[model samples]
Every structure is written in C-alpha cells, then in structure tokens.
Target: MSKPKENIFDFKLFKRLFEYIKPYKLVFYSLIVLVILLAAFSAATPYLTKYAIDNSIITREEKDFLFYIVMMLGILVVSTVFQLLFIYYATWLGQNLVVDVRIKLFNHLLRFKMKYYDNSSVGVLITRAVTDMERIADIFGQGLFMIVRDLLTMAVVFGVMIYLNLKLSLIVFAMLPLLLYATRLFQKYMKKAFEEVRTEVSNLNSFVQERLTGMKILQLFTRENIEYDNFKAINERHKKGWLKTVWYNSIFFPIAELSASITIGLVAWYGGLNVVLNEGGVSQGDLVAFIMFIPMLFRPLRQIADKFNTLQMGMVAATRVFKVIDTTSQIDDHGTYIAENFEGAISFDKVYFNYVEDETVLKGISFDVEAGETIAIVGATGAGKSTIINLLSRFYEIKSGMITVDGIDIKDVTLASLRTQIAVVLQDVFLFADTIMNNITLNHPEITEAQVYQAAKDIGIHDFIMSLPNGYQYNVKERGVMLSSGQRQLISFLRAYVTNPSILVLDEATSSVDSYSEQLIQNATDKITKGRTSIVIAHRLATIQKADQIIVMDAGEIVEKGTHDELLKKENGYYKNLYEVQFLKEHVA
Candidate 1:
C-alpha cells in the first residue's frame, strides 16, 4: 500500500487553483450574492409561517392569513429561482475553469524534458490530466460556494430560532458539541480513506492500461491466470479503500440524524410545555417555527462535514497537478537563433552522456559529416548507436559536449528551428489512428495530397498504397495495428520524405522486416537520401555498403571510421568483423 500524500493543506497549491477563477471573478461574486439571497429567502419562510400562525390562526384573523400565505408562496418561488441560477453558474464556472486547467497542464506536459516521461507512468499522467481534473472541478462546483450557501442558511436559521424563543433555541443547540465532535472525527478518518482511494484509483488505472497494452504478450506466455489474480488483488484493495469511507459515513450520518432528532424532541417538549402551561414565555407560533428551524440548523452541519471532505479531496488532486506544473524538467528554449538556410553540416565534439549517473552511454565521442554526406553508424546492441541519434535531435542533452549544425551550436538555436531541419524515421514506426494521407502529412497543411502521392511514387510505394481499400483515405487504426510492420515502415519513410528535411535519420529503419519489405524500404531510402545529409543506423551492414562513410562503434567510442571498402580492408577491424558475421549469417539463412 502506497502511503498517501501527508499534507493536503498546501496553501500554495490552493492559491494556484484559485488563479484559474480569476477570469470569472464577476460570476464568482454574483454567486456569493445569490448564495446570500438563497439563504435569506429560505430563512424567511418559517418566520412567515410563524407570523400567520400568531397573527391570523391563533388570534382568529382570517383576512391577514391569506396575505402571509401568498408571501410565503412567493418566497418559495424566489428561492427556487435563485437555487437554479446558483447551480447553473457554479457548474458553468467549474467546467470552464477545468478546461483552462487541463489545457495548461497538457501544455506544460508537452514542454517537459523527455527524461520526465522516462521516469513517469503514462497511466498516472493520464489520471492527472483527466480524472483528477474532474475532482478539482468539484472544488468550485459543489465544494466551496455550496458550503458557503449551506453555512449561511444555517446561520440565518440560528438567528431566527433565537429571535422566536431563547430558551428553546438554547435547548436545541445543547446537542451541538456531540455532533461537532463526531464530525471532527469523521473528517480525520475520511481524509485518510479518500487518500487511499485516490492512490488505488491511479494504481488500478495504470494496471489496467498496461495489461491491455501487453495482452498479446501475456496470452503468448500463458500468464492470463497470473495476471487475473493480480488484478483481483488490486481491485480488492480498491474496494477496501472505498468501503472504509462507506463505513465512516454509516457511522457519522446516523449520529448526526440521532442528534438532530434529539434536538427536535427537546424543542418540541420545552416549547409545547410552555405554551400549554400558558407561561407567557413561548407562543404557539414560536413553537411551530422552532420545529422547522431545528432541521434547517442541523442539516447544514451534516452537509458541511461532507462538503469539507470534497474540498479536501480537490485540494489533494490540485496538489498533485500543481506539483507537475511546478516541475522545472524542461529543455531551455530561450535561444533566439533561427537558421534561415540550414545546410545540414553536423559535428559532435568529445560528447559524453549518461542516462544514469556514473554509467556513461557515450564517452568522449567525436564525429563530423559534411553537407549532403551519407554517414552510417553500426555496432552491436548497447554500443551507443541510438544514443548518437537521440543526442543529435536534442531528445536528451549530452552531459559534457557540443553538438553543432552548420557551424552553429545546436543548443544556441531554438528547438523548433533545429528539429524542423531534421526528420527521424525510427525502426518502430508509430502511426496515428487516421487516414493514410493524414498519417503521411501529419496534418501539415503545407504537405498536400499531391505532394504525398508524388513522394510515394518516387519511393516506389505508390502502387502498394493505391492498392489499399480507399487508398489514401484508408484509416490505419491505432498505432497502425491494421498495417504490417513493413507497411508501417514504408508509410514512415513517406512521412519523413515529404518533410524535405535538410538532414534525414533512419535509425535501424530496416532492421525488422521481410526481404521484400526491405527491398521496398531500400528503394525508398535511396530516393530520399539522394543529395540529402543522411545518418543511417543499421544492424544490417548490407544496407550501408554504398555509404560515403561508415562509423563503427564499440562500447561507447568510435572504434572505426572510414568508407565501407577502406574499413573492410583493415585486418581485424570492428567494421570488418561485424560485416563478416552478418554476411555469414545472411548466406547461412
């Protein structure tokens, strides 16, 4: 069981939540007035009933009774109108505020350094952005202003009770200390229960999302029973957390009702006895009104306790959200430089990088590629082959090094300008659930259907694409699940090609595919790489044989750098050994 956040009374987080309401300050102030109006009208009804009882019924004055009845009816109509307005605007304000908050959170998320995501759960982040935001909306909708309305109603009721009869009012309020004590205890336990529930909700979401995503692997390995048992345990914990809150409610509400019943009984007994005895202290009208006022007083207390829990829950959700917003894990994009004519000359000078401390992935590496040159990086797994591409794209900053493009330090240029000039096609191609044309263009208005068609034609995949049902309008489905691995890679090639990037990176783009798909990708690659600065990372040495230069890596350093033929001629060279092993495996297969 994860321990919940200890401090829910974070003023800073609460202040940030309030900042979203600034735009609707007018609505908020109007709500406060409406709340007061609601309370005033509600509190007036019992008094009007008492006046009719005393001035008309008890005194046998029928003429005045009709006027009081009409007045009471009018108050009820007005109260209902105010209640409707309060709910509509409160909910409206809450919904609009959440839209702003969620958007702000999403924008912050988009700018975060990729390392933040590397260490965070996708499900947890989704909870923060989606479900948790709904809870925060409750802060405005049902928590703050609603509580104020209830409290004001209770306050007015209290004043009316005393104004009618002091002794009976005192008797009614005598039970308050017990109810307040119970409410205090309920709040303490409920806060802990709610925290546990929230934590379990996030855990369950993450568990379900991950399981669904990996369902194929789970079934392949015959782990269905094991995973089911795990889910059952998690779900059981979730149920237990909610049940704790239920148990606390079961105890607290009954105590509150019992206290209210006792207070009402006291008011009835004391006020009725005085009236029957003709003591001249309590009147018939006053006794009638006390009955109505007692519930009015006690109901708000009960609801306040409940709404306080809502307010606390929202505070907890806000704390989590603001924590993410407050995080400084973002790449510095303060550089004002933007290249007007990017030439794609690349350089890495003594780069050193580590995903984890004391465990370097790239060690003092250096390399250079001229404009329009095609360079291939080859090595075994964990030879820092992919790290080089990541650094080049500024996905992860190098620990101590300088990477430059066209003689300008890449760090000194805006990320948009720097990345706009480069396009990467990863081995694992990800396509959105959309039409093939939209996936190819990625919604870039500049890349039209004609451009996509021509790019596909040049890559020799035009026929393959046109063969599909609906052709360019065909929906690929989520993550391109409807397409084969090779077909998805081909789409990615077209996507990269249409961008007309100054530098093109194909990171092991042909590593996993059939021979036929590889041939298609090779053709596409040849066309795209023509006269473009290209960096090809490949496990298959055959793909890079015609490269202008080949850099062989071992561990973290560049062990060999030369043209394919020059490196192959060196005795016992890293490139020569890699080539012979792969060549033998190909022929043997």
Candidate 2:
C-alpha cells in the first residue's frame, strides 16, 4: 500500500482563494447578519417558553399568556423568513464567485506554454476546473453558513445558561472541554480519510478519460478483457478508500452522540438536585429551557463536525487547482514590437537546441533564406527537420544563438504579430465541427464567400464541395471525422491560402493523401508559394524537385544543399542515396 500524503498548508493559496470572493464582500456581510438574526431568534425561543411556564403556569398569571404565545409564534415566522433570504443570497454569491474564478482559471490556462500541458494530465486539469470549483462553491454556500450559525448559537446558548443558573451552567460548561478534545482527535483522522478519498477520485477520473480517448486502440488490439480487469482494479481501490472514510465517520458520529447524551444527563441530574435542595432554586421553566438549550448547543457541535468534512474536501481541491496556476512557463513573451508587415527574410545564427539537456536534437546550425524564396528540407525521421520549423515559429526558443526575421531578432517581435504573418499546414489535418466555409475562412474571418469559393477552386476541392448536399453550409462532425483525410487536408490548405501570409511552412503536407489529391495539393502549393517565403519539409524527393534550393540533413546537421538536379549529380551524397531509394521503390510498385 502507498503511504498517506502529507498536508501542506499553503497560506498564499488560501489568500488567492479569498481574493476571488472579495468582490462580494457586501453580500457576505449581509449573509452574516442574517445568520446572526436567525440564531438570536432561535436562542430567544427557550427563554420565552421559560417565562411562560414560571410566570403564567406556575404563579397562575393567565392575563398575558395569549400575548406571549403570539409573540413566540411571530418570532418563528420572522426567523424563517430571514433564514431563507440569507441562504438565497449566500448561495447566489458563491455560485457567481465560482463562475468568475473558473473563467479566470481557464483563460490563464490558455495562455500557458505547451510545456505545461506536456507535463500535466488532461484528467487532472479537467477535474480541477469542473469538480474542484464545485467543491469550493459548496464550502462557500453551505459550509460557511453552518460555521457561522453554529458558533453564534453556541455563544448565545452558553451565555443564557450562565445567567439563568450559575452552578448548573458551570456543570454544563465542564463537559465542553471533553467535547473539544474529542473533536480535535476526530478532525485529524477525518482529514486523512478525506484526502485519501480525493486521491482515489482523481485516479478513477484519469482511468476513465484515458480509456475513452483510446477506446479505438483497445478494440483494435482485442484487449477488452484486459482493460476491463484494469478498470475493475481501479474501481475496487476507490471503493476501499470510500469504505475507510465511511468507517471513520461512523465511529465519529456515535462517539459525538454518546458524549452529548452524557452531558444532557449530567445537566438534568445536577439541576434536579439543586431544585430538591431549595424550593425555588430552579423553576420548572428554567429546567425546560435548559433542556432545550442543551440540544441547540449539541446540534451546532454536530454541524461543526460536518462542516469540517466539507472544508477538508475543499482544501484538497484548492491545492490541486493552485498547482496548475502556480506553474511558470519556460518561454516568456514580453516583446512589445509589432510589425505592420513581414518581408519573410529568416536567418539562423549558430542556433542550438535540445528537448532534454543531455541529448542534443539540433547542433550549431546556421542558414539564411531570402524573402520570397522557396527552401525544402529533406531528411530522415529524427534528422531535426521539424525542429527547424518549430524554432522559426518561435514555438521553442533556441538554447544558444538567435534567429531573426525581417532583420529583427525573433524574440524582439511580439509573438502574436510574428505568428500572424506565418501560416503552417501539417501532415495531420484538424478541423472543427462546423461548415466547410467556416473552416476555409478560419484564418481570416473577414474573408468574403466569393474568396472562399475561389480559394477552394484553386485548391481543387471546389468541385467536390459543390457536389455535396449542403456545400459550404454542411455541418462537419467532431474533428471533421465525417470527411475523408484528403478532404480535410484540402480544407486546411484552403484555410492557409485565405490568410495570405508572407511566410508559409508545410511539414509533409501531401504525405497523407493519394496521388490524385497530392497533385492538387502540389498545384495549390505552387500558387501559394508564388510570392511568399516557403519552407517545405518532405520525405518525397519528387515533391521538391522544382524547389529553388533543397537542403539534405543527417544527425541534426545539414550534409548537402543544392537544386534537385545538382544534388542528384553527387552520387555518393545523402540526398543522392535518398533519391535513388525512393526511385527504386516507385519503379517496383
């Protein structure tokens, strides 16, 4: 079994949580006052009952008995009204506060760099955003109210008890220390149990999310039975955690009830002795009122125990959420330079990079491409072709040296403005569940319908789209699952073209399509690259045969550079070998 985790009290995290609630300070204050009023009215009821019993019944003063009964009834009605209003506003404030916090958290998460997501799990983040916010809201809505009401009720009841009869009051107060000690012990165990439950829940949620996302892979591998066993094991672990919590809570409640019963018995026994010893030492009214107040005191104690459980859960959730918000991104964007236009002149000056410190993915690389020129990078799978493109886009900053665009260091340019001037289309195409027209115009929302159709026509997908039942208005399914891979690629191409970017990056853009669709994409690529700087990363030698310059890479270093024919002339070079291999494969096929 895994050892229990330690509770790390983060005062800063708690302060941040309170900041979210600061906007509703007035509402919180009103809620406190309403609770106080309700508690005061509840505490006064027993005193009124005592007055009626001692003066009206015992002394036979029946003159104002009806008025006293009416007054008590009126207090009950007023208390109920105030209590309802208090709960309504308190709950409303909590829900709204949660909404504000969730929105802020989501927006902040969006601004985080890709490295953050690489280290965190989707299930954990989702749980924090949805489940944790709800738990915090429950604390504010119900838990806080319970705490305030219970404390107020206890204070008033104890004060009234002391004023009514000092000796009996002291006897009642003496039991309080025992109650507090028991509660302290219970809380220690309860916090541990609740933390275990929370961890189990997070694990279960991760299991479900992983399985759902990879359901296809599981079915393809015929691992249904194996996966089912794994799920069962996880569920059983969660069940055990919950059972432990239940067992602890079960013990807690019984001990609390027993202690309360003993205190009540002591009060009745000692008060009875005092009454018998002196005829008017304590009246029947006083005895009845003391009995009523005993339950009120114990009731709040029970509520305090319950609220402690809720507070424990909220604390666990708060800790998880703050973990994400506290993470610092490696690549910080603080540039204020915004360029009106990019000429697309890119230069790499002795750039070095590595995803891990000990393993270098790219060596000291130096290259320069003029504006409006086309460059093709051909290399093996791990030859750092994609890394070059990622660096040019500033997705990953170089460890040493620098990259410049339009004669300015890339770091000096605003990320938004820099990326806006460049368009990228990867091998795997992703589309939203929206109309074809929307997908095409995604890069430039203000593009006209005629421009969208012309771009689609230029890309050779217009005829196929026109044949569809809904044409541009058709609703695509999630991730464009309804469309073929080639069709999705064509849509993505149209999206890139509509942006009219000054620089274009195509990373194996035509690798997934058939020969026919490849021809259309090649034609579209030619038109898109006509007046823009283009970087094409491809394994197909034929795709970049007409490029102005072609660079061949090996082991993170460029080994060859020239036009297609010039590289083919160097028979012993890496480019020549790759071209011959691809030629043989095509001929055999």
After superposition on all C-alphas, the RMSD of every candidate to the true structure, in Å, is 2.3, 2.9
* Model 2 agreement with the true structure over 477-524: per-residue lDDT tens digits: 778878888888888888888878889999999888888888888889
Model 2 ranges off by over 4 Å: 1-12, 273-279, 435-450, 466-469
Top lDDT prediction, candidate number: 1
Give me the overall lDDT of model 2. Answer: 0.82
Segments in model 1 whose C-alpha atoms lie over 4 Å from true places: 1-10, 587-589
TM-score of every prediction relative to native: 0.97, 0.93
- Each model's lDDT: 0.89, 0.82
Clashes of each: 0, 0
Using alpha carbons, what is the TM-score of model 1? 0.97
**Residue pairs with backbone atoms closer than 3 Å in model 1 (clashes):** none
Query: Which window of ten consecutive residues has the lowest lDDT sum in model 1?
Result: 5-14
